[model samples]
Target: MAEWVHDLGGSRGFGPVEVEPGEPPFHADWERRVFGMTATVMAQGRANGSEFRHAIERMDPGWYLASPYYEHWLTGLATLLVEKGVVDREELEAHGAPSFPISRAAARADVPPGAQADPFAVGQRVRVRSFEPRGHTRCPGYVRGHRGTVVRRDGDHTVPDVEAHSEERPAEPTYSVAFDATELWGSEAEPGATVHVDLWHRYLEAVE
Candidate 1:
């Protein structure tokens, strides 16, 4: 059997979960370390010194839930590396086996603005444009093609898909958009329900 470590929220303490020996660890590569480091830097940059820690504390509330741990690690690592420039798109591709450029000369004409471009504001109405979905997609399975309004837009950041695979193209800027739960789930959904997700600018279109 394999043992996993977990933190109990609110100063309770850390504990272990036992699993079958052949079972895979949640974070096979344990990439969360990189993610945590990057998050810490970003938090400090935004004057939210304890933001990352606070998020972690809120997420783990005693009882353990089964989830794809490595996915979380990958998500966090991709975000941090791109944010801190520890792993650029070109570098990631180089690290991958037999690297090849994913972008064409036309697409490589210029560098796109990322987090350093401009600040995002709230109450912006946006629509997600349709695109060929491939690799890992952040555009949640449930919200595809669904019309919604942006309640809040978090600071700009690099898209994580390219980073996760080390694609040759540079990381594109992404925005955190919030949608009304009713809009996505329809009239049957709770009146005040809502869901927030990070989406790259390329994935959205401004709808009047």
Candidate 2:
């Protein structure tokens, strides 16, 4: 499976994650403003959470890798605001703000309740599907094709893979699956180590 720039989990060459002690959430005023704007857009029903994330995934690989985290948020917000016809490119550049007091009365009207049955059970072994999707997916590339034990059933939720592109948010069961480190990272991984991931039902299949 060809990995997108955003799916860098378990990839090599990048340096170790450096943690800043006592780090603040926002580094600048613009980042805080961007976050608030994004929240407002979602509240207005102009966009959904999955749609917002897909917009970031659709960014140019070069710019995506080179930019900071909040910049990605800004880019996603801007893209959705334009695509949803809430604002045009000209108006966005000229005023850099959307009209105030947006409404959420009919938010997520297209999404119906989840009616799917849960097939897999706790402790059941399952394998992540290996197919490549051209659009947004919550499934991480590293877990694809690997077998894992379903540790917990997380109930039904909207499938991000579909919600990103379409207005309808069909529901599906999700599970917390536990995989041994060696299964994903080979023998070099630490002994007795395991990684847990929350995956949608469609991403897994019965291990036969």
Candidate 3:
């Protein structure tokens, strides 16, 4: 599977991480405002976490790479506001609108489905199923088709793929699967190392 530009967990060529010691969380006032807006939007249930993430992922790759971290949040917020009909594109462009609360109907629309039965057990061998997703997915590109052992069951959680584009928050069992470093990166990876990934039930299949 082709890696989405937003999902660069294990990829290379991005250079070293420069840490800003004692850095303030917000660089500018506008960034703080964007954070507030995002908090309010999510608090009011205008959009879910997965939906917001997918909106950021939907951004143009070049723009995404060029933009700052908070700008990505701002862009995702704007996209959700417009898509949810809370604000129109023209009103958003004008940037002079009165604030209104999100409707209760919208908040209550995503009543979560019942919890699903756990399909895989702890210490069970499984393989991540590889598939091309048409929409958002919690399954990362790096782990697809990889064999791993389920080390922990994370219980039921909302499936991101379903929540991203729809009003449904279906429950599914999640697991922390541990993959050997050498299994993923060949002999270059250090010995006695493992990478653990939290994955949903649907992403894995039992390996006999």
Candidate 4:
């Protein structure tokens, strides 16, 4: 079965990808315009990166399939600008393009106290929570409900889960966890194989 828009990773029914090495960033002139506009709006702090991605995620799944890569970015940018009151349909239709000044506060983001203390230390065994989240998340689908050993501590930073919905960037200690490929996949995976994922502390709990 295919998971809809929110549930990416470990889902089925994706087409095979053809990698084009040394490909230019923009394939067409319209792509360049879209990319530049998105970049400018983001650089000006109309919305944060989390909100930008959440905008894309908010798109109808059917719309998502029809959109090309840069089109998604353009959609995200337009959504944020309109939703945040930075721009409106009238201005866009009349002016053709829009730009706004970024606030100083938006430039240097503030950290929220989302983390009290680190849960699992280095070399500790932890299992990822299996439940699906209703909101935006950074956890990869394949790693959920699986156990891994913490190999490194990435310190504390903004949690994307909350950041997507609000202005706050809640802090959480991130970790580099190593999972045996067999655990995440199955015995079908090659023997002695492993995968490393950088996960937030909230996604994991002590295994023992």
Please count the clashing residue pairs in each candidate, in the order shown. Answer: 1, 0, 0, 0
Give lDDT: candidate 1, residue 156: 50
TM-score of each: 0.41, 0.86, 0.85, 0.82
What CA RMSD would you report for each candidate? 13.8, 6.1, 6.0, 6.2
lDDT of 2 by residue, 72-112 (tens): 99877877777778787777666754542221221321222
Q: Report how far off residue 138 is in candidate 3 (Å).
A: 1.4
TM-score: the better of candidates 2 and 3: 2
Runs of candidate 2 with Cα error greater than 4 angstroms are: 8-10, 95-118
The residue-by-residue lDDT of candidate 4 on 140-197, one tens digit each, is 7788889999999988888877787777666778999999999987977889998999
The candidate that achieves the highest TM-score relative to the unseen native structure: 2
Query: Candidate 4 has what TM-score?
Result: 0.82
- Structural RMSD, model 2: 6.1
lDDT tens digits by residue: candidate 1, 1-208: 0011222111113356457778643344445555565557676663132222222222222222343554333434443444456667677667653542222111111212233423334566777654433333344545555666666555555454343334334444456677788876678788997777777765666666
Off by over 4 Å in 4: 6-10, 90-117
Which window of 10 residues has the lowest lDDT sum in candidate 1? 1-10
The total number of steric clashes, by the backbone 3 Å criterion, in model 3 comes to 0
Report how far residue 162 has shifted in candidate 4, in Å: 0.9
Candidates arranged by TM-score, highest first: 2, 3, 4, 1
Count steric clashes of candidate 2.
Answer: 0
lDDT values for all models? 0.46, 0.77, 0.76, 0.73
Candidate 4: worst-modelled 10 consecutive residues by lDDT: 100-109
Arranged by lDDT, best first: 2, 3, 4, 1
